[model samples]
Target: MTARALSARSLLRWLSLLALAAGCHVAPIAAQELIAHPSAEIATLTRNEARLYFTLRLKTWPNGRLAKVFVLPDNHPIHQRFTNEILGLYPYQLRRVWDRQIFSGTGQAPITVDDEQEMIQRVATTPGAIGYAAVPNEHPDLRVLQVR
Candidate 1:
């Protein structure tokens, strides 16, 4: 092959490899869903309202019940997905909001569960409780909240 032809082929091969590498690192869109106790009076929330609940800014349900919030640890994959995909916020931003609330003595952080199982159990048993998980419908005791 001519030297020019060889160089062009090499460049094409490098570009193909680079594109594959970039595609491998791209994150898949998460499928996390917001869940609540089966008895929770609220069925749907605006995205802003859901954000407020997770941030500890909104304290009560529309039915006048205290809104109990549960969460997985900050570093858990499901928690990260929930914060990023559902709430449209990073985990650190949520932590900062909670920390400020605690330091200011005006609010408290959500109850942190160990894993998805515990998250489901807590939300199912705790009245007015809300949380997020993958496939929340699998548990009949938990209600999936629609975020509009």
Candidate 2:
């Protein structure tokens, strides 16, 4: 083959490999659902409202009951996915908000659970509690909130 043709072929091969490598590093966001205690009384929330709840800004349910927020650890995969997909924020940004609230004495961070199982359990039992987790069909006591 001609030298020019050989160079173009090599360049195309490298670009293809580069694209594949980049694709492999991109992790797909998992399906996450917003779950709450059966008694929470909230059926739907806007994405902004959900962000407020998780960030500890919205303190009370619409019915005036205190809103108890639960969350998985900051580094957990589900937590990351929920923050990115539902809340449209990075995990560290959420953490910064929580830490600032905790340090300023004006707010309290959400209760952090160790895993999705614990998240489901806490939200199920805590009155007015809300959290996010993988599709929670196994637990009938948890209410899946619709996020607009």
How do all models score by TM-score? Answer: 0.78, 0.78
Model 1 residue runs over 4 Å out of place are 1-29
Give the Cα-based TM-score of candidate 2 against the true structure.
Answer: 0.78
Candidate lDDT values, in order: 0.83, 0.83
Tens-digit lDDT track for model 1 on 1-148?
3586568658856776787888854222465789998667777899899999888788888887888999999999888888866776789999999999989998999998999888888898999999988863678788888877
Query: How well does candidate 2 score on lDDT at residue 42?
Result: 81
lDDT (Cα, 0-100) at 92 in candidate 2: 99
Those runs of model 2 whose alpha carbons end farther than 4 Å from true positions after fitting are 1-29
Candidate 2: tens digits of C-alpha lDDT, residues 19-125: 78888542223657898887778889998999988988888888888989999889998888898778878899999999999999988999988988888888888
